[model samples]
Target: MILELKEVHGYYDKSHILNGVTLSVGQGTSVCLLGRNGVGKSTTMKTIMGMLNPKEHCKTEGSMKFDGKELAGMKSHSIARLGIAYVPQGRHIFPTLSTEENLKVAARAGVDGSCKWNLETVYTFFPRLEERKDSKGDKLSGGEKQMLAVARGLMQNPKMMLLDEITEGLAPIIVDQLASMVQNLVAEGVTILIAEQNVKFAMKVSSDCYILERGAIVHHQATKELTAETRKKYLGL
Candidate 1:
């Protein structure tokens, strides 16, 4: 396994958001965390990213291991340096910076003999980004901004990526493009953990899926086994 979470518990201030969440991800595989809104899916991503402070009431219990290294007490920057890249929920891009500049700003030196993902590579994955290389981040459409966000994370040359809501609030065509991009990334051996509300999209790209409800995992199964009836019942479809 490239990543493992053992009985992980996380809280935001007084509210306990994650209740003994456990999950794992293998190299070159994709897993989707599925749920309705406010089900601790995003919180799980934040916990894995080390954004929610372990100290000062935002408590985390259990263990998080990345490539055999314990990641419980690491800082957010340290976690990033350890080859974990996160594309946050809202495409948080620097509005004043150009698309190329945004990617450059997130680039870091390669680790573990991994090739550094440069502008050329990101452009290859998202040609729209290449077309808007000189355009300010604020000028791009919603889909373009989301693509840039994913590209920025890739520039860090991470072994695995945690994507939160990659296809939220986009047109059907744009969503299809994003889904194709994710499939390509998986084909190239990048481990992906995506938290999404779009069950159809998630099932299309992920081999494994976990459904979360009220900070707990309600169901987990292979994507092929997820039925429409199950989705309608558990996901309120």
Candidate 2:
């Protein structure tokens, strides 16, 4: 396994958000976390990223192992340095910096004998980014900002990526392009864990799916089994 969460529990100000949540990801595979609003989907991502300090009121009472190393109590920066790149929701780009600068900020030295991703490789995946390399992050459109966020994460040359709602409000055409790019990334052997409300879009790319409900997992199955009918019944489609 590349990552595993065993009976993980987390909270926010005495409010329990994750009730013994457990999941795992294998090497070079894509997994989608499906859920409606307020189901602790984003919280799970934050917990994995170490953004929500578990030691605080948000208690974490389980094990999070990545590549055979325990991850509990680790800081966000430390977790990031462990080769887990996160492309958060809303494409949190540095508005004042140019697109190229934003990507550069996330760049790190090569890891595990893999070559680091550079400007050329990012441009190959997102041609629009090349055209707007000099443009400020805030000046880019929604799709463009999203591209920059993904490119920034790629600059780290991470072994796995946690993508939270990468295709939320973009146009259908742009969404299609993003999906294609993700397919290409998977082909390059990058493991991905995507938390998405867009079930249709996720089903098109992920091989497996885990349905989350009220801070707990309700179902886990192959993506092909998540038909429209199943989504309508379980995911409130």
User: Which residue pairs clash within candidate 2?
Assistant: none
Q: What's model 1's overall lDDT?
A: 0.90
Give lDDT tens digits, candidate 1, residues 1-237.
999998888888989889988888888999999999999999999888887884666878789999899989888999989898999998899999999999999988656766658888888878888999999999999999999999999999989999999898999999998999899999988899999999889988999998898888889899779999889877998
Q: Which stretches of candidate 2 lie over 4 Å from their true place?
A: 54-57
Q: Tell me the RMSD of model 2 versus the true structure.
A: 1.3
Candidate 1 residue runs with Cα over 4 Å from true position? 54-56
Best candidate (score: lDDT) = 1
In candidate 2 the C-alpha lDDT for residue 145 amounts to 95
lDDT of 2 at 52: 74
Task: In candidate 1, list every pair of residues with a backbone clash.
Answer: none
Q: Model 1 — which ten-residue stretch has the worst lDDT?
A: 108-117
Clashes of each: 0, 0
Give the per-residue lDDT of model 2 (tens digit) for 105-165.
9988656756557888889888899999999999999999998998999999999999999
